[model samples]
Structure formats: C-alpha cells, structure tokens
Target chain A: MKAPAIDKKVLYAYLEEIKDPEIPVLSIIDLGIVRDVVMNEEGELDVTITATYTGCPAMDMIAAAIRVEMHTLGFKKVNIRYAISPAWTTEWMSKEGKRKLKEYGIAAPDKRFSIPADGVECPRCNSVNTRLISEFGSTACKALYQCNDCMEPFDYFKCH
Target chain B: MSESLINYTLHLADNALILGQRNSEWCGHGPVLEQDIAITNISLDLIGQARSLYQYAAEKMNAAAGKEHPAVTEDTLAYYRTEREFKNCLLTEQPRGDWAQTVLRQFFFSTYQYYLYQQLQQYADTNLAAIAEKSLKEVSYHLRWSSEWVIRLGDGTDESNRRMKEAVNELWRYTGELFVPAPYEKELGIDPGSMQADWMKKVSAVFEEATLQVPEKIFMQTGGKTGVHSEHLGYILTELQYVQRTYPGCEW
Candidate 1:
C-alpha cells in the first residue's frame, strides 16, 4: 500500500524553506527552479527541478539541500529530477523574490526574454544611470555594475 | 550503443573541458579585477557545459553490455583519460599566450560556438539539442564579451594593435581544425563545414571593425579532433589529472 497523500501546498512550504546557496534571500521556489512536486503510487516524493545554468555549482548543493529538507519533512523515498528542455529563464523569478533581491542591495533581473542588455537600476540609489564594470560578477548569474549616482558598485542579476 | 554518437559527445565535452582549462589559467593572473572575473566566469560556464556533455557521454558508453567500467562517470572521463584519448580541437588546446591572444582565442571559439549551438539546437538529436539550446544563451554573452574585447584591443593604442596583430598571426592557423569534421562527427551527421561561411563572415566583420587584417594565406592545421594533439594537451592533462591519477577516485 502507498503512503497517505501529502498536500502539495505543504510540500511547497517545505521547499520554500530551502534558500539558494549563493543568493540567500531567494529560495528554490523563489528562483523558480522547483518545477513540480509529485507523490507517486510507490509513495516516493519526486521533485523535478531545473538548473539556472547547466554548470551552476549550486545545483548539486541545492539538490542536496532539497533532499535534506524532504527528509526532515519525513520523505523516505526522495527522487530529485532535472529538466533542461524549455530552459530556465530569469522571467520565472517571483515578484516577491525580485523585491527581496533588490532590498539585499543587488539589482534584480528585469523580466523579458532576450539576453540582458543594461538599464539596470541601482538597487541602492535607485538610479537608471549605471554603467557596467564587467559582465561577470561574483557568481555566474550576476554581472558587476557601478552606479554613477551612488558611485557604488553592485551586482546585476543577468537576464539569462 | 551508437559508438559514433558517443565519440561525438565526448568530442564536444573535451572541447569545452580543454578550453575551460585554458581560460581558468587567468583566474588570478588577469591584468585587472574585472577582466580576471570575466575570464574565470567564462571558464566556469564552459566547464559546466563540459560536465553535462561528459555525463551524457558516460551514460551512452555505459549503456552497452560489455563495458569495462559499467559505472563510468563524468569524473572518470575527465580526470582519468590520457592526452591522446582527448578529442578536443587543436584551437582549444593552444596555450593561452597573453591577454591579446586569450581575447582573440575566445573571440574565435565563442563565435564558432554561437553558430554551432544555433545549428545543434535544431538538430535531430534531442539531448545534444537541449544542451546546445541551453549553452546558446551563455555563448551569446561570451561572443559579445570576446568580440568587444577583440575590437577594443585591436583598435586601441599602437601597442595594443601590435599585440592583437601578433595574436592574430600566432593563432590563425589553429582555427581551421574547428571546421574540419572528424570521422565521428561525420558518422553522427553533424557537418562542421556547413557553418564555416557564417563563422568567417562574422569574424571578418569583427576584424574589420577592430582594424585588424584577416589572414590571407591560411595554411590550416588539422588533428586533435581525431585525438592527435599538440604537446600542450599532454601538459594540460598532466596538470588536470595529477590528483586523480595519483589517487584514483579521490573525491572532495
């Protein structure tokens, strides 16, 4: 016999507790990497997720954190799956997540398809007059930018 | 199992691996902080692409019944393989000579990858297509970054222009290998030759804008795709595989 049906909402709540290793304020749910959660007939808890970047080192860490969180939630058979088809886009990042990211002093990605060209508002001084220092920042997903208004450099979440 | 497909996958993985390795040499050695981070970030992306391709190749190799290591993995493929067994193109294995050379090399490879991924994303092979599609996004940035640098350096001060010219002369011969389809690539129905025109058009336009001359007398070098490599690959493998060979399967 299969285990009792668990609420998908409850599973989401558990998942929301797991934060991104690099970006602490955003959880996997906020990042939109958690694609689906399924309770199979065999009572396995399968979480389908996508990587922000195929080679993002955080994927393995995030997957491990998911396993630990699920275990704490009492999931005995946890299967973490990866999907790469439609590809993960910054568009999937949540509105609340964006706000949090901005508050954390990093410019959050503005939603839209194509590659991220500049026009990132300074998360500090809230100025549109920012120049890019480098297209690569501290992490793979971020790029370094400096605000002419604030004269302070910060990271911009690239539109990939 | 389709051996040719597996080899093609390995070739793709190896190209990314070797190029990533070369780029990573600039991790702490860059002229400026931003440039250092930029090259390192590109290295991360390429290495990440390599990991996905290697995993796909490992799975294909293991699917057969008579495999020596039934549990072969990406790690084994990357760290255990000898130099002659690597199937990366010669251009990727070339030494990262100087800042100008690195920029030019990245420009050439990223330009090739941008077009290559565009083609591969439309190909019949789904997994390869998916990886290509995903990589296309990152490769676009790489192309932009490298292209901008190529122009900046080539069109910059007199010293910068001279260095860029030297880089172009030193590196031009190795690029031909990218268009030369290997035996495995031919078997897998991927034509490297088909993308040559597009690649050159983009390169020539960039060179024009950079005020640099495209090589007129191109004596194209070949090999590396078929496993024959420059001496550089041996040194690279020695550095990369040192820990793994010394203590097999050692993990952090």
Candidate 2:
C-alpha cells in the first residue's frame, strides 16, 4: 500500500501544537527550534531543529515529541535532523514567544549582543531595576534573577 | 570506524567529560550566584560535547565490529572505563581547588579549545567539522569569560591577587601536556602542537592584561595523553562512575 500523502500544512499544524517541555508556554515553532519542514522526493518528512544550548537537556524530549506528533498525524516516513551551524541564538526567538515568556513569569532575554550584566527587567513588576540572583537558573538556559522593587525572584531566558 | 578515529573521538570525549565533571563540583558552592551559574553553564557545554563525541565513537565502534562484539554506548565508555583507558590532559584532571584555580584552569583550557575547534571546523571529516563548529562558539564564550575572571581576580584586591598568583603558578606545569598529541590523534585529527603558538599568544595577552606573569621558563608535565594521570583522576572517576557502576545501565 502507498503511504498516505501528508500535506506540509498539516505537518506544520501538528508541530505548532507540540509545546517545549521546558517552557510549556511556547511551542517549538514559537521558540524557533523548528528550523524547517519539507517533504522530500522520497516522501520523507524531514524536520530540522536547533538546540537552545548545546547541553539543553530538553533536546531529547523535544525530538521525541516531534516524532510522536508526526506519528499521530499519520506520517510514517518522518526523519528529525539537527542543525548545529549558525548555532541557536536568542535572536531566533519569535516575538510571540517573548510575550508568552513574560506572561509565564520568566524574563525574556534583552536585545543585546553581549551577556547583559544589568538591566534584566523583572517579569513580575516589569521593573528594570533588577539584580542577578544567579548566573544560572534551575535550567542551563535560564539565569536566576530577583526584582529590586517587587522582591520577586524569577528565571531569565539567558542569551547564548 | 578506524581504530585511530575511534581513539581520537574517545580522547576528545574523555577530556570534556573529566573537565565537565570537575567543574560541576562548583554547582552550588560558588562564591556568588552569578559565577556559580556561569561555571555550571561551562560544565554543561563540555558534557554536551562529550555526549556527542561518545555517541559518535560508540556508533563507529559498533559499525566496525558488528554483532560479534557487545554493544558500546556513551555510558559504557564514560562510566565503565578504567583509569588507563581515559585519555584526557592532566590539566583537565587536576583538582578544582579554589575559585581562582578553577577560573585559571578554564582560561588555559578554553584558549586551547578555541583554537583546536577552529581548526577542527575545517577537518576533512564532515561530522567532526560539524561538532567543532557548534562547540567552537560555546568555547569562545568560555574563553572570554575565564579570561575576564583571570584579569579581575589578578588585579582586583590583595587577597584575590595572592590567590590568583598561586593558581597561576600551580596550574602552569600542566599546560605543556596540552600541546603534545598522541600518534593516533595526529593521524585522526590535527596535530595539537600546531595550535600551541596561537594558544600562547592568546594566553600571554590575557596574562599581560591580568597583570600576572607567565613563568619565564618551566618544566612541562606529560602522560595524561597516554592515560597516565595524577592521583586526582582516580577520585574524580570514583564520583563520576559511582551511579552507573552501582546501578549498571542506570538512566536519568
């Protein structure tokens, strides 16, 4: 029997529903982990992803999730590939992803080239006067921070 | 799948794993929160690289031997290997004594890694080149971070200055072994010795800015490349391998 022809649009719709295991507020699509999805001549659906950090433990979960989503969508010939070149950067994060992060209480990364030593606005009060509690947060991709004004501690999505 | 290639990959994996394990000791014990997290991030990057290298090594070994040989995995390579089987440099296997020592050691190693990976990005082997390309960016940040700490601690205050000097003196001996490449390493990868001149220039510039002196002349340590490490590695492996050894194929 011939493999059912799966439309690229349907595959993308399914992918957009798979949320990041670490940050449930955003899907892999919003986080820019999904670099591209294409149906090749052989009809294999190839999904390319870039990791937020080299050691971001969520990578395994992300890959597994992608596989599960594709299988659910009736895609049998799905291959997940990693793109390490142009290494994943905070710049790839979508505008909607940044908004969701704030709503979820993790401070979005500031738009700066270097690791920002200061001016990490607190997710709680939107206070720009925040202090770095720790350079590392509960996860490798986040930094610990506290608001000087609100005194609320939160995670900052660290820029790579 | 060549033995030399497998060995070369193992060599890289071991260095990253050992050093990453060492740096992880500072997870929550750092003097301050920011630096603590920074060091751990460095640890994560190293271990991540080690995982990819080990996976590559295992896959290559499995392909070469077929079903006649037992399975080889990243865990087995890391947790089951004996002291003599590990091929990391002595600098990486050394103890993470103080914050200054940790920072200084990272500075030396990261500088070498930056140049090493830069060359690796252009290797004839595409897989190796890809790994290098990804890792080089992370190592670049590590080099800068450690370099700043060296300068800050060296020039900062009286006590910090004294400690930084002590760290510099103690770690300097191990620097020599990093440049000496094993025969297999040369065959499978670029000769590490070729990167020494560039490594020195970067190191010297950082040391100069740190207002610290590199010893005018010194004796270099060897043997880590040959799997002969200091007593420190034994203890390191004990902690590192404890879980996998105890559980036998334990998973997170």
Winning candidate number (TM-score): 1
**A-chain TM-score per prediction?**
0.93, 0.90
DockQ of each: 0.84, 0.49
**What CA RMSD would you report for each candidate?**
1.5, 3.0
**Total clashing residue pairs per candidate?**
0, 1
Every model: iRMSD = 0.8, 2.6
| Model 2: per-residue Cα lDDT over B156-204, one tens digit each | 8999999999998999999998899887887765689999999999988
lDDT of 1 by residue, A35-151 (tens): 999988778899999989877999999999999988887788899988888788898999999999999998988754135555578999899888878888899899888888889
**Candidate 1: stretches off by over 4 Å:** A111-118, B66-69
Which tens-of-lDDT digit does each residue in A68-143 have in candidate 2?
8888766677898888766787778889999999999998878562474556888889888888665557777787
Ten-residue stretch with the least lDDT total in model 2 chain A: A110-119
